[model samples]
Target: MNLGPLEIGLIILAVLLLFGYKKLPDASRSLGRSMRIFKGEMKGMKDDDVRGKEEATTVRGQLAPPAAASPTAGAPDYEAEALAAEARAAEARAAEARARADAARSGVTPADGTR
Candidate 1:
C-alpha cells in the first residue's frame, strides 16, 4: 500500500496528538532509536548469513584456527620471561640502594657525584 503525503500527515497528526507537544520530542527520539536498532540487527543477520556461506565448507567441530604466522609466536615461556625481567629489575634496585647507602656514609649525594 502506497502512503501518500496525506496518509503520512494523518499518521504524524495522530502521533502528535497521542503524545502531546511536551512529550513529542522524546517520543520521536525513542522511535528513531528503535528504528536504528532494528536496522543494525537486520544488517548483522545479513553479515552472519554471508559468513556462514563463506565457512560452509568447514565442519564446525574440526575447524582449527590458522597457525601462528609470526616467527616468535611459538615461544610459550611468558611467565619465565616475566620472572627474569623482574629479577633484573630487582638487582638494579639493590645496586642503587647500595650506592645510596655508601653515599650517605660518605656525606655525599649519589646524584651529584661530588664530595
Candidate 2:
C-alpha cells in the first residue's frame, strides 16, 4: 500500500506526460480550491448542527413551564426561582459562618459538633 520513491517518481512522470508542466499549476490550484470548498462545507454543516441543538434546548426551556404549570396560570418564572436559590445558598453560608464562630467562642470543635 506504501509507494516507494520509484513508484512516486513513475506517478509524477505519468502525470507530467498526461497533463504537461504548463497545465500542472492550474490543475493543482483547482484541486486546492475544491478541497477548500469541501472543507468549508463540512465545517458549516457542523456549525449548523450545534446551532440546531442550542435552538432546540432553548425552545424546550421556553415550552417546559406551560406544560408543568396548571392551565389557569401562565409559564413559571425561572428568574425568580434562580434568585430564590441564590438567596438560600447565601443564607446557608451565613449560617455556617455563625456556627463556626459559635464553636470558636464556646471552645467546641466544629467538625465534632460539640460545645
lDDT of 2 at 48: 58
lDDT of 1 by residue, 33-60 (tens): 5565456556755865565544443334
Name the best candidate (by TM-score).
2
Candidate 2 minimal-lDDT segment of 10 residues: 63-72
75 in model 1: Cα distance from truth in Å? 30
| Model 2 Cα lDDT, one tens digit per residue, 1-115 | 9999999999999999999999998788657655654565567558656755564345446632443555445655554555565566557656765675576546576795532
User: Which candidate number has the best lDDT?
Assistant: 2
Candidate 2: regions farther than 4 A off: 60-115
TM-score of each: 0.40, 0.52
